[model samples]
Target chain A: MEQSFDDDEGVRWMLAWKAGDEAAFDRLVERYSPQVYALLTRFLGPRDNREDLVQEVFLRLLRNRDRYEPSARFSTFLYRIVFNLAVNHTQRVIQRAEGSLHGRHGDEDGEQLAELADDRASAPFESLEQDDVVRAVRSAIASLPENQRMALILAKYEELPYAEIAGVLGSSEKAVKSLIHRARETLRERLAPFLKEELA
Target chain B: MNLECAAFRRELQHSLENHAERSGAPLRDLLWHRHLHGCLDCRELLSAEEALEALLSSLPNPKLPPGLAQRVLARLSRPAGAQAELDALLELDRPESARPGLAGRVLAHLAEERALARRNPQPVRDLDVLLELARPVEIPVGLAERVKNRTRASTGTRGVLLRWRWMAAAALLALLLGVYAYYPRNPQPSPMVAMQDQPDPALLENLLLLEEWELLQGGDLEVLLSTLPAEDEYLLDLGAEGATEQGGQPKKG
Candidate 1:
């Protein structure tokens, strides 16, 4: 599906799924799976476990189908669960690096976000072998303190507004902007070689 | 880079990041503030940013691993098959992954505070009563007369209600915090943007730093809102201070 169902439609589907309309649950999966898969890949790198994590997100959705509240946007609830799952999986390796020392106050709320390519054996990102610009950008993104990276993905790729991004990350909009700003600055620094070369 | 260049770079970045600065602000505004006319490096950086942004956004989403949705649906369909496993998998939620509504609790706290405050509101003692407490006469009669007259002039015109300006401000501040707490949760853009117009939050924020909220009374919210600094100024202020106050760190309630 080129453009999946909108958030309202997703809510309707959730309501239907809650009403025991099994097809509604399928529609919900069809609408959100690519997005969930893409977001998980962005956050955790291209690991096989992401497939399982994506499944778990849906399973949680099935379990919490009754927990869906119409007052909030369907996407907000879904993304909160998604990001939370991503954060849980990330803290093990990401927090081990330099970000642990330069910890932001928001770290405790979200997953301890900061990942490493230079660290221990399980360098999941090593699987992503794109070309130069792709490689450099991904590296810079991966190197970002996890919170900044998550904020950047939601803002830059997901195109979620700052406010929604903040909610999903369990942060304030101002902090979301700060996260993106810092993320951008770091990316510029890390990808300086490409940017400077492109400028020349 | 030298400190001056660093400062220039910072200013330039702010100008670029800020939509108002990029679209409407003239170079003369920055040039007047700093000697930016001679710098070639930042000039190139400023221009090259568009290309950089294109490059940044150009990175595509990875192709989804095949059958990702089919697999999710497969599990959803076969509830009986994965029942025990799904039940066990649900237990993986560690404590940090939980996103309880901190705002709901803080807002409840604020409500309890407001209720308690209302039940035992600030005593509305008269300013004259307060002033009378300090009236032991040890001064020369002339000096005492001068002091008393000035004191009367200051207090007589403002009346006693202004003494409760702190309470009014606190009430308004609580109202403002409630409105602010609504922003993150409000998914719609127009409503949240409209909420910004109700009262000048920045102006009200300064109220918290006061011992007595003398600038505003209960009736003055509309007056203050009407006289607020321009929207561009607010955005510029947020952009400038965001890095330090709002953006710098996570301030947990």
Candidate 2:
């Protein structure tokens, strides 16, 4: 069974925090930080910057906590923040690469492998074969168009409802469904060989 | 598979994700079962889709790094005192006599009570009576103390004088009520006199003049003034301005 945190608990923490109870605010962060971190890692991929991005996401939450209402689910609200931050970070990296004549011939590969190990520890695989499959899936996911990738990540990984995915993507639910359908078809085509082997 | 059979298989796969249960939908279930039995190609496709869904669902939940909670708590703790200061500022911003919406109104009432309690710090007899009189309303959390502090600051020395004035007003109200209880009931005044007793003549005249005027001023005036009977066309005598009638009737003096 999934260990679900009561939404009311976060609301209560907010109420208590508003009432000048500091401990309640701490408890609120403790309750949600892991989920937020997991979501960020899923979106941004296993990288050294994941922890820093996670911190930034929480810092953003702290800065804007007063604005949080119980309208959307807390996870939805949190995921939206993580999604935007990850997208912005990706855009920045792209921009940096475009500006520089010499690509930052940094040790990104080594760092990425270490981060991958850490990420895999949290997202346990049945075997090394499964890990390779996951890595291949991640690469295929990255190759998708940005909107399609975001839709796929939110739907397949985050398990957000179609409506919430629409909200995050600023598209209609019908459009979001089409994007996911297209994305899934692309993944199926791309991973056909691996999947066929697995089935065999 | 035939194009028709492939399309049917695709629809079944889509419905499996979108719909809650496929059990009782006769045509759909029959199509699905038939496709699975007769078509190896469709069967493999369906199995692949299910496996993909299961794999997606099986992604593990990650945990936050050590001490992350402590860091968040530390940041949140610093904000408390700052929030109190901001609360005071916000209280100063709000109107004094105006009732805030549900949350704001409740907080204001609580703030007033908290102030009173702070001033005495001693147990007062019939504190519950005072509380009932005050009518503590539910406020948005964290607003009351802010409102109270600001109210206290702004009122200054006049706070005590305002309390005395309130007591005096209460006493006068009680006196009026006692006199009203013992006094004999007078007969209801005539409608004209009651209308006259209303302070504004412009309001009364506006009430009487219906139709074009009422249409411009909107609302259910017909319902409001339904008791007044409609009069037949009154003379629009131009005699006051010394004009003669074309019909040759003598002008009334």
Whole-model lDDT, candidate 1? Answer: 0.61
lDDT of 2 by residue, A1-200 (tens): 54343555766676575555656656767888767766776666655456555555655555454445555556666677777777766664554444442544345434444443433233222333565766666566666776787888777666677887887777898899899889888767766655665566
Candidate 1 residue-wise lDDT, A1-200, digit = tens: 34333457877888887765768878888899898889888776665557766776775675465556664567777888887777655554454344455764454323323234421223223423334576556666777776888888887677677777877878898898888888887777666666766667
Report how far off residue B112 is in candidate 1 (Å).
Answer: 41
Model 2 chain B worst lDDT window (10 residues)? B232-241
**All DockQ scores:** 0.20, 0.13
Q: Candidate 1, residue B137: CA error in Å?
A: 66
**Which parts of model 2 are misplaced by more than 4 Å?**
A1-24, A101-131, B1-31, B54-64, B75-253
Model 2 lDDT tens row, B1-253: 7986768667865554443344535342564686667778777776676555545544455545677656544432334465467567667776877543333333434444443454335464236325423423688887989899779966887766676887888999999999999887988788877654543456545544543343522224324433333321122232211122123442333
| Candidate No. with top TM-score | 2
| Candidate 2 accuracy as lDDT | 0.58
Model 1 regions lying over 4 Å from their true place: A1-7, A93-131, B1-42, B79-253
lDDT of 1 at A22: 64
TM-scores for all predictions: 0.46, 0.49
